[model samples]
Target: MDFNFLSPVSDLVLAHNALLSSQALGSKLRIHSKNQGIPDLDAVGIAIIGVLENRNDVNYIGEEFNLNEIRKSFYGLFPGSWSSVVADLGDIEKGERVEDTYFALKSIVSALLKLNIIPVIIGGTQDLTYATYRAYDDVIPMVNIVNVDCKFDMGDSSKPMKNNSFVGKIILDEPYNLFNYATIGYQTYFNSQEEIDLMDQLYFESYRLGEVSNDISLVEPAVRDANIVSIDLNSVKGSEVSLNQKFSPNGLDGKEICAIARYAGISNKVTSLGIYEYKPSKDDEMTAMLVSQMLWYFIEGVNLRVRDDDFADENSYQKFITLVDSQELIFYKSNKTGRWWIEIPFLADVNNKLKRHTLLSCTHQDYIDACSNIIPERWYKAFRKNSV
Candidate 1:
């Protein structure tokens, strides 16, 4: 993998430290873009996270877009006292890269859970999926995984590897609760027949843009149910913004993609999240700017969801339960699956064998495994605490 050494904003480390020092360091997040921004828009508070570092990757129109400059502009969002995390993988042997990436990946997710900070990872490519799941496992168990992309990304590889093959490796290696996974916006030509076949065999839901209407309601239930979200920009239609090979013209519109992003955020089931394949080299000015805006809106949605208070008394729980239970789902079962195949519906269906739980019995890992369904321990505790 070739690394571009051109980081436009050089004081990122300094800014990162300032943000870290200001936080309570142990409590749940109290700040949000809707409220005061990360550190405060009253000052230069957004600059700390900086903009995304630009490098090489495939994008729409078959070109590379360099984002180094926008990254500099984004740094302006942070105040004088903020910072972002940059994990670099210099040249390492193939066997070592996966484990090494896992280490950095795990640490970042751990920090998110610990510090209440949102992390945006720029890629070495899609194998980051391995790192994302490993870290998520640390905090939650039996959760849903959602991929909003144009390809199954289930490429063939001989061993545990990176690039496109990681998705295939995950499918091959794990005995999944097929219902726990979902894919969207896949274009016809971008995938091979065999890849297409395997993807269909799974129990998870899929929404091909060519086959369905523009309304996301066809697939909104699964997205709402996800515990972790892995969004590949290739899922977007063939526009100047999509920076990945095998892209297609008739994919998802940006507005639709952002709608799903907002939905994922508001559900707050996303414990570990990533949006990959944004080739800075191919993206023009508008594309780069939209990336930041799209991501910010997603966070804002989640912040709104988490901040909005609800109780068993107010009927929000009842409304949520009814809404969730009403969604149409196609179930798939792969033999020799596990003892239990679960879906967490909160108050939606308490009598479900796979639904109800010993209250507060779940660890962070358990909640993540259940995805959008399980209440985060913090949410439960805080709701109870505030109610008291």
Candidate 2:
């Protein structure tokens, strides 16, 4: 247990409770309060960990951040009807160098995943997402990442890693494990024209903030299909929270962001989640509270997850095949949840992690589009990527 890398939570924060008649979340969380004592990994399915390294943020240089307020805000909330056990494993202090912090985070996240414990990370900067992606190297052969941000962070990979461009490192790095990368709630103005065009050149997926906010359900399929989800706090509008850095005038609102968090949580494939680029300010309790609510909703979604990945169970889903552009498109509708998935044909003798006839999550509209002789963009992308 690389629990040695973690620092225990202070008793003061753990002791703080919201004024309520019933028990609050803080009263229920098992805390890592002792140096040698850590929460029992077997007891909890979700482990909350905070990172205090923010040197990578381009704008907020030398600013300090601690997750104590966020934890207090989260722990004060009422827990929903959930079955999975949760524990706060405490925080990871910044190391002598930024890489040291990344290494510790990667090790901790990887260890937690090996124990079947999903890590809910409270991060200092979005670049920490690089470490989270690296944690999947040996654990899973390939991964699909869904980033919820206002801009595509695929900055110059040739340059050093920073919060603004860490995604480039994930894509260009060794072992080449990244299969698909999708960005939801991206505002075009924040991104460079080259980055936007690169997104197309790489066969990646990007959804405009308007497209998703207009129909919140549109984000469901992308998040549902991801194995890892990284959400930048900057993706939320400035009106909703105090702007420390990575500020945006227009982005996903409070309810919309929480809904996306729930979508990421409900995904059976999403093993790790990180909420990043958050800077705590003394005057704003609302930002901490919002982050806490987002965490709560994610946990709620995890507990409410339905396992419908097994398409072989004929009684569990109805299968439909449509012919469009001389290609057969297969779609599956779950009987339990009515959720939909479109099948991507398997390429034999190809180096791939996805199994034969992979079912990609999609919306009802995608099915309707296919029937109208239109090939869903998601289906096409998956097919092209899988064949590569």
Q: Using lDDT, give the best candidate's number.
A: 2
Local accuracy of candidate 2 as per-residue lDDT tens digits, 1-388: 7678899987667556434334787767777886437977776889999999999878764778788888878887889988888989899999899999999999999999998999999988999999999999989988999999998999999999999999999999998899899999999999999999999877899999999989999989989989899999989998889646437779999999999989988998999999998887765587898899899999999999999878778899998999999999999999989999998888888876586677889999999999999999999888888877
After aligning candidate 2 to the native by TM-score, how far in Å is the CA of 301 from where it should be? 0.2
* Candidate 1 lDDT by residue in tens digits, 1-388: 1122113223442344245433322111222222232332222111112222121122223332333433433323422221322221111112233465456555545555444544545443556665566655546545567787777777765754645666766655654322255677777677798877775455445568764345565554456557767777767766736343326666777787777777776654555567666655543555555565565556556555542222324333211121222442111121221111122324442333234421211222333433455444323332232232
What lDDT score belongs to each candidate, Candidate 1 first?
0.47, 0.88
Worst 10 residues of 2 by lDDT: 14-23
Weakest 10 consecutive residues, lDDT, candidate 1?
A: 332-341
Give the number of the best model, judged by TM-score: 2
Off by over 4 Å in 1: 1-67, 73-98, 114-116, 174-179, 211-213, 242-246, 306-314, 317-388
Q: How many backbone clashes does candidate 1 have?
A: 45
What's the distance in Å from true for residue 152, model 1?
0.8
